[model samples]
Target: MTKPNILHESPSQTAGPYVHIGCAPNFVGIQMYGGKDLASNMLDPETSGERITLTGTITDGDGKLVLDGLVEIWQADANGVYPSAADTSGTADPHFTGFGRCPTNLDTGIYQFQTIKPGQTKMRDGRAQAPHITMWIVARGINIGLQTRVYFPDESANATDPLLQSVPEDRRHTLIAHKLDDQTYQFNIVLQGDEETVFLDI
Candidate 1:
């Protein structure tokens, strides 16, 4: 499928606002929490239940790895429940692990995740299901951080999902996933490319 043009915000232009422009600094101490709780509570005798091996590469407009960029991902366990007041205030679900952040090493682009697949999320409109993974991205030159979701291509429900549908149909493919294998999926986000990943104001 052809990618959408975002630079031309005009209706006739047919492109959305550009994303992943410059880059940001590598801040070592900027830690933040996420909305949902998807941590594994079941302790492993060998190590902590949390998976720290979530790995992947951040590619640039030329399909080059942005080695110095940082990526953070947060999601619920396979159950699709987030860490919220409904379960416990100021805390996350014991069974539903809540947060994970990893900085890219020397590769300038590869990242890894030792976590399981995220479950289906409740639709904002209360009538549909959406499956995705939330990612907060920061590069070396960019000042403002980018917030977006990495959606699964196999999730057929996304066709009718509200959040997915809210984006123009031409831009919807940005959220789609590229399967690497049965156990791993690759989603290359673009700050500015043919099809930039969809970013929400919230």
Candidate 2:
């Protein structure tokens, strides 16, 4: 599918990393369903991966220049289905909008998002449960994209998840996230190398 155009913004110097433990905000917890105070699954998170003008810069450990980073992500619907392809009552689910975009942030890293976490599917091996969510990532200098599945750490099902199992034990910690507060989340991403994340080839 052709990529979508995203609203552009100059990289803000204000964005900071969640490096200091306890320095991150106390994120509000979100239930998977649309209930009382929760945001409906209508928020869009999409951006570009190739062009620095499209994606933003990525900051290093010292909050330095990490450029040309492209990121792409896919997620299931609120009902979790490769959400973009979902239809409802022959009309389409108005509440369920499947979206994807690659937008660069002030830090020079491309940001991409699609609505809904994919429903848990068994890995080819057929041995575990799978959790899902909107995946966000920053890559190295626009040549390749990094892949990491954002998962809720509190989910009881994560323990039995098959895809989680596919990840090496030492690296599994990167997949889990703590609820910092409502609307925003706080999680640290580990890039590959001496301090690398398990990035996907595609």
Candidate 3:
């Protein structure tokens, strides 16, 4: 019998050391893209809403910081509308991109983004979701990027959010970003061990 022309799938690889070079060239002082990294700033003066800053560190299973990690966030505008073509509401803030990216500071091992606090959004099933930001993280040893959400603490809607409620009571705190101030929040991500953040498969 003739052997089938089988094409094997390539094995997955981790985001190597060069991830910063390709994803955020300016981070390594390459001076590309007008000397700024993509999604480095998610806001402009005209972007509507209360401006806020998010800061976090990514820690590995051994409690060591992942200094070279990259974090990206996607969130709806303050009016609960997404600035995407897929958002048919036609009410999304034109000045808000609803996305941001930052590479971890080599020395501090922290990533930060300046953005507006997202408003409550609805789930596919028409359930109201609490204000949250979707986060994607990648680093040297992470074979596949990890995905999670940063839900603001003290939001009344959190009690009814479908996704937040789906998480176990003990693990739900892993998804919340603690308020550091009126305009800042901190959300450290633990990649393993007892306090591992609740990652979503999606």
Candidate 4:
């Protein structure tokens, strides 16, 4: 008889304050560990595209922010091409890295990512998807990191985005970012309660 192959699930751990220590050693006064941390910047001065700043706070149900939360975002280049070698659609901007990371400020509980405004990318069905930034968040009390996407309220594509259309109309606003200025945006992440951000399965 063949033995049943049952695998034991490993326990999940909440990302604690030490995530900053392990991921961003230099930011917390720790040095000499390795090369330029996992992600200190999303691009160089020569990167192509309209650079923008994304700022937001991750808060609990009561509106209190998670000061230690860490945020990571991924997006395509200005032309809607990804930088990965596997991207066969076209060549992404050579200067764009397409990824960024930021840890929330200890006092203000705000996290900021400076990167270019992402262009629309393609979905598996060959349909053009809306321009957006996908984000992952982690903090002390979060057993598993939460995943969400940020959409621009001013973008015309948001009206027909397949993903956005899938979400209930009333709750879709939680994922849209508020334009603070020509080059700045605010997209808060709510962990619980009525205003919880829409977390994706992946």
Arranged by lDDT with the best first, the candidates are 3, 4, 1, 2
Would you estimate the TM-scores of all the predictions? Answer: 0.66, 0.52, 0.93, 0.92
- In candidate 1, position 185 carries an lDDT of 74
What's the residue-level lDDT of 168 in candidate 1? 87
Winner by lDDT between candidate 4 and candidate 3: 3
Query: Higher-TM-score candidate among 1 and 2?
Result: 1
Which prediction has the highest TM-score against the true structure?
A: 3
Q: Could you tell me which 10 consecutive residues in candidate 4 have the lowest summed lDDT?
A: 1-10
Where in model 3 is the C-alpha error above 4 Å? 1-12
Instruction: For residue 8, give model 2's deviation from the true position in Å.
Output: 34
Cα error, candidate 4, residue 62 (Å): 2.4
User: Better model by TM-score, 2 or 3?
Assistant: 3
Tens-digit lDDT string for candidate 4 (5-102) = 96666767888977888877777878746646777788888898998999999999988989999999999999999989888889988888898888
Ranking by TM-score: 3, 4, 1, 2
Largest lDDT belongs to which candidate?
A: 3
Which tens-of-lDDT digit does each residue in 1-202 have in candidate 2?
Answer: 3356865644433222321111112112333233222222234344211111111233455555543333344554433344333322133334444434343342534333324343554444655456554444443333333556666657777888866777889888766655544323334455534445455543
The per-prediction tally of clashing pairs is 36, 37, 0, 0
